[model samples]
Target: MPAIVEETVQPCPECGSEIRGDGRFTLWCAACDWNVDPSEPQPDAGRLERAGRVLARRHGEQLLGEMLDGSGGRPRRDVSAVAATVLALAVHAVTVVLAVGGLWCVVALGGGIGVVAGVVLLALAWLLAPRPGRLPEGRPVLLRADAPELFALVDEVAGAVGTRSVDAIVVDGSINAAVTSYGIRGRRLLVLGMPLWEILTPEERIALLGHELAHYANGDIRNGLVVGSAVRSLTVWHHIVQPLPHATGLEMIVNALYVLPRLLIGGWLILLIRLTSRAGMRAEYLADRLAARTASTPAAAGLMDRLLITEALGVWLRTEANRAALRGPRSTRRATDRAGELWERLTAYAASIPEHEYERQRRAGARRGHQVDTTHPPTHLRRACLLAGQSEPAAVALQAHRSDLIAVELAAARTEVARRLLRGVLDD
Candidate 1:
C-alpha cells in the first residue's frame, strides 16, 4: 500500500473539527455550535491597537539604541538583533557629539563664527534625534480597566504563557493584535481588535492573545519603545525645520538653510530606517515562536492563516455592501442594536463565496505575505516557524465558554465603536 500523506491543518475553534485536510471542498464545520464563517457571528470580544500593529514598526529600536550606546557596535555585544539599531543610533550620537565638540571649540577659539556654527548644529541635532515618539492618539479605542471578564482572559493567557500580565487592554476595529509601552514610565499595553475577536474560535483567540503577549515576554515591545521611535521623524526632518512656504523674507532663508541640509542628509536616515525595519522582522519571528509554544502549533498557525485571509475575506465582505447603510438614515444609537444584523449579513456574504474562490483567496494571502520595511515577516514564514517547533499538534480546548459572556458584556462598547467607525468614515 502507498503511504498516506495527511497535510496538517487547523481545527475548529468550536467543536474542534479539522478545517482543512488532504480532502477537498469543505467550507463549514458541522460539529460546532455555529459555522466557522468569515468571523464569529456573535460577541467574541471587543478591543485593540489596530493601526499601531497594522502599520510596520517605524523606528522603535533605533531610538533606544541611540541614546543608550556611547561607542556602540551593538547595543550590547551579547544581545542578538541589536546590531542594526545600535549601529544606527551610535552613528547618530557620534555625529551629534562631534558637532557639539566642534561648537564648543568654535565658541572658545573661533569666537563669533564658531558660535554661529554651534547654534546651527545644535538646532539640526534637535530635529534629527531618534528618540521614540508617541503613538497616534485615536487609532485605538481605550476601555476602562473595570471590564473584569476581559481582564480575566488576559490574566489567564498570561499565566498559561508564563509571561507578565499587560497593564491595559484596548480595542480597535482592525484585524490585528499588538503590545507596546509608551512614555518615560513605559506602561505596558495590549491591543486587540474587535474584528479580530469576531473571527477566531476561543482557543484561536487565546492563540492570538498568546502571540501578542509573547511580544511582552520576549521584551520586543519594551525594546521597541526603549530604542525605537515612529519613523516619521526621518522622512519629515525637512518639514520639521522648514520655514512656512509663504514666507519670503529672512524666515525663508533660514528655512532654506535648515531644509536643504536635511534633504541632502535624508539618505542616511533612510538607511537607518531600513535596517531598523529588518531588525523588527527578526523580532517578529521570535514572537511567533513564543506564541506557538504558548499556544499549540496548530492554533498559532491557524491564527496566521486567518490573519492573512482577513484582508480579502472578513474585510471585503463587511465593507463591500454596508458603507452606504452605515452612513444612512439610522441614528448612532440604533447602529449598536444592529450588530447582530450586520454580522449575519457579513456571514452570509462570506458564505456566498464559492469554496474554490475561498481557497484561491487563501492562496493569494500567502503570496502577499512579505513587504520591505514591514514589522511582521511573511505569513508563510510565521507558519513554518510554528510547525518547525512542534513534533505533533498540541490539543487546545475547543470551547472557551467566554464568548457569550464577552459578547453580552461588550454589546454597548461594540455599538459605540461601530458608531465611531461610521462617523469617521462618513463624517455624519
Candidate 2:
C-alpha cells in the first residue's frame, strides 16, 4: 500500500484555533470561518429578475417538501404543463397568422401602402419564428479526433444517462459547465469551464458530465425548442410595444398606442413562465436523480457542494490574477512560469476548503433558498434529493490512467484559456 500523507494543521489568522488543510481545498478555521466566503455579495437584481427568483424559490420549496414526504417521484405531465404547452402553441399560431396575413395583404390588396404593410408584417413573422441555437465563437472546440479520451468518456457518460453523445466539447475559462444544442440540426455541444474542471476530482468531473447530459434525457421543458422560442418571442413583443421615454407629440402618441399591447404581451409572458415553473423544477430533480444513478450519490452530492462555492472560486481567480499582475509584468521568465502555475494553485486552493465551511454554505443555502439561477431549483434541495436516495455504484468509472490521458488531451486548450485570463488581467 502507498503511504498516507496527513493534512497540515495550523492556527487560524483570525482566531487561534487549529485548522487542517488538505490537498483538495483551502483550509479555514472551523471556529472562526476565517476565509469561508470572502467574495462580495452581488448587487440586487431587477424587478423582473427578482420576481423570477421568488417563483423559483416557491416552486423549489413545494417540490422539496413533496420529495421529503415521499409525494414527489418522477415528474408527470399535469394540467399546468398542458396549459403551458398550449400557450406556446398559441404563440406559434400567432406567428403563422402574421405570415399568412402578410401574404394575403400583398396579393389581394395590391396597393403601395398594402405592399409596405405586408413587408413589415412578414418581417415581424420572421423575427418571431423559432431559431436554432448556434455554436459560440472564440472558443476552443474539441473534436473526437483531437480528444479521443475525453470524447470517449463523454460518450460513456451519455450512454449511462441514456442520451446520445455531443458533437463537440468547448472549453473556456469560466467556472461553469453546460450542454446546449446548436445549429439547425440541433447538434449537441458541451461547454466545459476549465477553472471548474481543474478543481474537480475525476469522479466529480464525471458527476458534472452526468448531470449536464441528464438534462437532455429528462426533457427539461424550459430548455425545449417550442417553449423556449415562445418565451423569446414574447420578450421581443414586449420590447417592441414598450413605450419610449420622454417622447414628444407624434412619438408620444405612438408610445401611448402601444401601451395595452405591451401590457398584454408582458402578462402572457409571465403567465407562460409561471405555468411551466413547477414542471421545470421537477425536471431538475429528475436530472439530479439520473446524475446520481450514473455517477453515484456521493459524487453527485460532492459536485453540488463544489457548486456552492463557485462564486468564491471565481473571485479567488480574479484576485490572484490581479495580484500576479501587480507583482510585475510577465516579461520575466519567472513571472511567466508563475502565471502558468495559477491552475495548480487554484486546484490546491479548492481542495483546502474545510468541511465546516461547506456545511455553513449548505445551511446558508437552505435559509436563502439558494439556486444556481432563476431556472434551477435550490441547491440545498438538489443535494438533499441525492443524499436521501439509495446509494449507487458509478456506472461510468474514470480510471487514473484514462483521467491522465484526458488531461493530456486538454493541455493545449487549458494553457490557452489560462493565458487569455492572465493576459486580460495583465492588460488592465
Candidate 3:
C-alpha cells in the first residue's frame, strides 16, 4: 500500500506544494525547503499540551471525581459537562412558569373571554415546547441485529473500542461515516456511507469507524448534541415569545410585553453556545487519539491521507462521474464496483496538480487560520498528530474471509444505496 502512497503526498508546510520524495522515504518540497521524514514524524507537543490544558480547565475535576467516595466532590460528568442541558432546562422551566403566570393573570383580570384567550395562548406555547432535535435520518437500508454477517465487523470494532453497542446501522448513498445520538438517553445510530466504504480497505474502514465510534466512547459527540439541542430550544423559545400575540387594538400593546424578556434570555443562550466551541475542538483531538488507539497510528494516518485527497478532489470527481455514469452503459450498482478505480484516478489527478494550485487550496482551507471549524481542528494539525511518533498500522482481522464477508454480506445493502443515489440523479 505504501508503494502507491506517493500518490498521497503531504502538503508542504512552508509553501503547500506537494512534497517531493526520493525513492526511499525522504520527502522534500521542491518549491520550499520543507523536509518531512515519514518514518520519524514529529509530534507537535504544543497541540497535546493545549489539549491537556483544555481538558484540565473544563473536565479535570470531573475526571478525578469519579474515583472519590460519597458525594463531596462534583461527581464524574457533574454539572459542568452537562451545564448546557441545565441552562436549557432552566429556560424551559421559566417557560412553564410564565405560561402558568399568564394563565393566572388572565383569570384574575377577567372571568369572560380574556380567560379563554389566555388559556389558548399558554396552550400554544406548551404544545410547541422544545424537544431535543430529532436525529437526522434518511431512507437508507438498515442493518438489523439479526444480520450477524453485517454485525460481525461492527461488533468487533465497537468491542475493540469499548463503546456501547450500536442500536442501528444504516447504509447511505453519501460518502461519509458518522455516529449520532439524538436526545438525552437517545440510542446511538451508526451511518456507513456506501461510497466511502467502496473506497476504503478493511483496515482503513476500521480507522474510519473507530474514529466515529470513539466519539461515542468519549462523550464528545454527546456534548455537541446537548449544545445543539440547547441552542435549538433557545431558538424555539425566542421565536415563540418574540412575535406579537393575537390581540385587538388596545390589547396588542399589552401582548408586546413578551418581546424584551425573550431577547435578553435568547441573547445569552446564543453567547453560551458560541463559548462551547473551544470544548468542541478539544473533543476532536481526543477522539482522534482514541481512533489511533483502536485502528493503530498508521491506519489512522492512511485514512487521513485518503480523506485529504478526497476533500481536495472528490467533489469534482463525483459530479463528473455521476454525470458520465448516467450517460454510460454501466449505471446501476455496477458503478459502485468502480469506486476504488475512481478514487485512484482522482488521487492521480490530485498528485498531478501544480504546486501553486496545491498551495492555493491549502491557503483557502486555512483562510481564517489553522482551525477547521468549531467542531474540528485543522487537517494539518490532525495529520501531524496521527503521523507523529506512531507505530505501523495495526494488523488485525485482515483475513481474506473478512474482506469477502464484508463485500458479499453487504452486497444487497450496497445495491440499495446505489439505487438511492441514482434515484436522486434521475429525480434531478
Q: Which stretches of candidate 1 lie over 4 Å from their true place?
A: 1-80, 85-145, 221-223, 230-260, 263-265, 313-327, 330-337, 347-355, 365-373, 388-399, 424-428
Each model's TM-score, in the order given?
0.62, 0.84, 0.64
Tell me the spans in candidate 3 whose CA falls farther than 4 Å from its real position: 1-85, 98-128, 132-138, 182-185, 221-228, 235-266, 312-314, 321-372, 389-398, 423-428
Per-candidate Cα lDDT values, in order, are 0.54, 0.80, 0.57
lDDT of predicted model 1: 0.54
Kindly report which residue pairs in candidate 2 clash with one another.
Answer: 24-351, 24-352, 25-350, 25-351, 25-352, 25-353, 26-352, 26-353, 27-352
Q: Pick the candidate with the highest lDDT.
A: 2
Per-model clash counts, in order, read 18, 9, 0
List, residue by residue over 215-316, the lDDT tens digit for candidate 2: 888777777777877888888887788788889999999998998887788789888888888888888787777788888889999899999888768777
Cα lDDT tens digits for candidate 3, 1-428: 11243344577788888664433233556565454222232343443234434433443233223212223211135444466556656766765776876687587766777787677768765754656534445545454544565676677777777776676777765657777654556777787776676666667788887888777776652345545556666666666676565778866775577768666856656555544544555555556666677778877876665565444344544564576557665663465554334434543554554444434334434432332333455565565656654464453355677778667766676655555554343111
Better of 1 and 2 by TM-score: 2
Each prediction's RMSD over C-alphas, in Å, is 12.4, 5.0, 9.5
Sort by TM-score, top down from the best: 2, 3, 1
